[model samples]
Target: MQGPHSPAPPVDVQPASWRDLSSIRELEKLCFGRDAWPWIDTLAALTFPQTVRLKAVSDEFVVGFIFGDQRRLKRTGWIASIGVHPDYRRRGIGRTLLVACEDLLGMPRVRLSLRGSNDAALRLYQQAGYVRIDTWKRYYRDGEDAIIMEKVR
Candidate 1:
């Protein structure tokens, strides 16, 4: 028997593999909608040896995912993508996934781009210590501007 005030168990974070592509693709569609990457790019992120791919799994399904690209020459890492299933939002899953990718990237600075209109994402990134650095006008296919944010370690 458990007490009414008992805290829930913690979720697990792990490196994702190509086998997780299907689950990740589903989550991508749910979170990014029209901005989701194509299947080929998703596959590459999961299977590429040097790429950092992390997934937040609960109940044996992927709830969130993040991909990081390490640019050694540039001395920075870029967050290629991040997504949390709609059912899993606001539970710190996205933040956990981002932190895991940052750790794996092991770079001095990490950067990500988001639609300028995505207030929720902007707030999350801001709370996690990322600051807006630049903006790309009409960067998305739908002609939405993208705000670039960076966290220096």
Candidate 2:
């Protein structure tokens, strides 16, 4: 008899370095399309000091990634960006990267901003204990308002 299918292997989240710039750039393009960060921004995220960068690897592939900026004076950590390849979405990769980055940031509060139209990301952040704190008008190049969210520990 055929046995029930086994669960897929859990994705591994690890620190991301400059060596991951190319892969992270590709993932950003795939996940954010025109809103994807430019190569320079992606490079900075991977190489900047006081930033927490993490990648979710599945089967040796960079399936998802996140970048968090730590501001010690303000005691706030800002999640600058997070994305998962379309094929890898909904498998907890985003959440995993998010949690890993948050842990590494070790801030009293963490914040992020996303397009108002991005319902999926909104739900994910909300489910992970974030709450809407503010909104920026015309935040994107295309004029989509950015919904800012915050999570305080």
Candidate 3:
């Protein structure tokens, strides 16, 4: 049995495999809506050895996921994608996944792009020490500008 004040069960973060493609695809659709990646892209991200893919799992179900691509020659890394299942938001799952991905990338700086209008995501990144570095005009398919943010370690 667990006490009321007992800590919540620990979430396991591990490298994602091709077997998780469907779960990741579903989660991307839920978190990103129209911006979700196509199935091919999601599959590639999972199987590409150079890419950093991490999933937050509890009871063998993926609750959150993140992907990072490192460019060692440029000393930078890009957060390819991040998404948390709707039921898992606001519980630090996204943050945990992001941190783990960054650690795996081992780059001098980590960069990510988010819709300028996404206040919740912006707040999360800001709180995680990411600073807005630039903005791209009409960056999204829907023509929404993208705010580029960076965190230097």
Best by lDDT: 2
Candidate 1 residue lDDT tens string, 14-121: 989999989999999998888889999999999886699998888677888999999988989999998887877888988888888899899999999999999989
Q: Which stretches of candidate 2 lie over 4 Å from their true place?
A: 1-6
- Pick by TM-score: which candidate is best? 2
Cα distance off (Å), candidate 2, residue 43: 0.6
Q: Candidate 3 has which clashing residue pairs, if any?
A: none
Candidates' C-alpha lDDT: 0.90, 0.91, 0.90
Record all residue pairs in model 2 with backbone atoms less than 3 Å apart, i.e. clashing: none
Task: Summing lDDT over every window of 10 consecutive residues in candidate 3, give the lowest-scoring window.
Answer: 1-10
Model 1: weakest 10-residue lDDT segment is 1-10
Clash counts for the predictions, in order? 0, 0, 0
lDDT of 3 by residue, 1-153 (tens): 659998766789988989999999989999988889999999999988779998999777898999999888899999999988887788899889888888999998999999989998899899988999999999999899999999999
The RMSD (Cα, Å) of candidate 1 is: 2.3
- Report lDDT (Cα) of residue 13, candidate 1: 94
Residue-wise C-alpha lDDT for candidate 2, range 44-121, written one tens digit per residue: 999989999899998889999999999999999999999998988888888888888889999999999999999999
